[model samples]
Target chain A: EAEVAQSPRYKITEKSQAVAFWCDPISGHATLYWYRQILGQGPELLVQFQDESVVDDSQLPKDRFSAERLKGVDSTLKIQPAELGDSAMYLCASRPTGGLGYTFGSGTRLTVV
Target chain B: GQQVMQIPQYQHVQEGEDFTTYCNSSTTLSNIQWYKQRPGGHPVFLIQLVKSGEVKKQKRLTFQFGEAKKNSSLHITATQTTDVGTYFCAGPISGNQFYFGTGTSLTVIP
Candidate 1:
């Protein structure tokens, strides 16, 4: 089975620093999502992309967070001047057009000090 | 904004017992999906319920969607240690946006 790939399984950085995470969705998937999950809580959507265009980003904190899927295949999420509260598991998921379910990557665990 | 809530934020059950979790959405849903996440692991898709009053079973696990299409439930029979994890229900609010429930964490004790 094809799997979504994520890099840097774990990361720890100081507050006010910049951090970035990458995700490569399965081939042929047109829908990609980036989610942030606090401890003991459900995942929260931060951004969604259709092909190379952003479809929804209302929940994203544009002041400090940014995400891009330039070619519609892989994506990158960045948080500049990270805050302590930003520590969480960042998950990336992808689904085919009109597909019923999503395949999630292992996720990048972020820890801000 | 849409929200999905799950009851019994946490559940502890003895091995071999049955367990169930309920998910309720603020608005009618086009479809509902169930996912399981083990400790330190990412969410894994388990099933999807579409039609109203639809029910599906996968081995010892059963899933049901309400007639109103606003709620759903997941039941596990003869729970085992491997069943320990958090269960989440998700529904799409629009063509591109999906929301996940608060999640129900389960701990099966042997």
Candidate 2:
């Protein structure tokens, strides 16, 4: 089974430090999503990308968070001056064209101290 | 912003016992999806319901979408240890933007 790939299974950073997470969706998937999941909570949508264009980022904290899918393939999400409240699991999911289900990556766990 | 809520945030069941989780959305949904995430793992899609009052069944799990498209439920029959996980219901409001329910964590003791 093809799976979405995510880097840095776990990350620990000091407050105000910069951190980044990377995700590579399954080949041929055009729709990609980034979600933030707090402990004992559901995954919250942070950003959505249709190909290389951002479709929705209403929930993303634009002040310090930025994401890019330069080639419309792999994506990178960066946070500058991370805060303690930013500690959570960052999940990446992708859906192939005409597919009904989303394939999710293992996720990047961030622990901001 | 959309809100999806799930009932019984935690469920404890013994092996061979049944369990069910309910999901409700503040806004009508075009479709609802269910996913399960084991402890320390990523979510794995289980099923998707698109039609109103639709029902789908897997080997040991049953899923239903409410007649109003604002609620859904997942039922497990005779759960095993492997069924221990957090189940989340995600509803798509627009395009690919989905709002997930609070989730229900199930712990099955064998």
Candidate 3:
């Protein structure tokens, strides 16, 4: 089965450092999403993209967090000057069409010390 | 912002026992999706419910959408050790964003 791919299964960084996570959704999928999951909590949407265009990013921290799907395929999410509160599991999900269940990658666990 | 609520934040059951989780939304949803995430693992799509009053089933799981289009349920019959995980209900809300319920954390005793 075609699955979403994520790099850096785990990351530990000092506060105020920069970190980046990567994701590659299944082929042909046009919609991609980034989510943050705290321990014992449901995942929260951080951003959404339709093809290479951002659809929603209200939940994203614009000053420090940025994401890009330059070619409408694999995507990269970066955080500059990370904070301790940003420590969480960052999940990347995607769907072939606009309305359907999403396929999530294993995720990148970030721990900002 | 949209709010999705799920009842019984946590559930504990013995092996072979049945379990169910409920999801409610403050706003009407265009569609609802169910997902399961194992401990320290990513969420995998279980099913999707569209149209008012829709019901779908897998091998040992069943899902239902309320007639009013504001609620949904997931039932597991005779769970096993592998059934232990968090089940989340996601809904497509206004502005093409998804709102996920709090989730029901299931602990299946071995």
TM-score of every model versus the real structure: 0.98, 0.98, 0.96
Whichever of 2 and 3 has more lDDT, that candidate is 2
Runs in model 2 lying further than 4 Å from the true structure: none
Give me the TM-scores of chain B across the candidates.
Answer: 0.96, 0.96, 0.96
lDDT of 1 by residue, B1-110 (tens): 43899998999999999999999998899999999999999999999999999999999999999999999999999999999999999998665477999999999999
Q: Which is the better candidate, 1 or 3, if ranked by DockQ?
A: 1
Encode model 2's per-residue lDDT on B16-108: one tens digit a residue: 999999999988899999999999998999999999999999999999999999999999999999999999999887666778889999999
Q: Rank the candidates by DockQ, best first.
A: 2, 1, 3
Expressed as tens digits, the lDDT of each residue in B1-110 for candidate 3 is 43998989999999999999999999788789999999888898899999899999998999999999999999999999999999999997757778788999999998
| Residue B91 alpha-carbon offset, candidate 3, angstroms | 0.1
Q: Write the per-residue lDDT of candidate 3 for residues A37-98, one digit (tens) a residue.
A: 99888889999989999999989999999999999999999999899999999999998885
Given candidate 1, what's the lDDT at residue A24?
A: 98
- Which window of 10 residues has the lowest lDDT sum in candidate 3 chain A? A95-104
User: TM-score (0 to 1) for chain A, all models?
Assistant: 0.99, 0.99, 0.97
DockQ of 1: 0.91
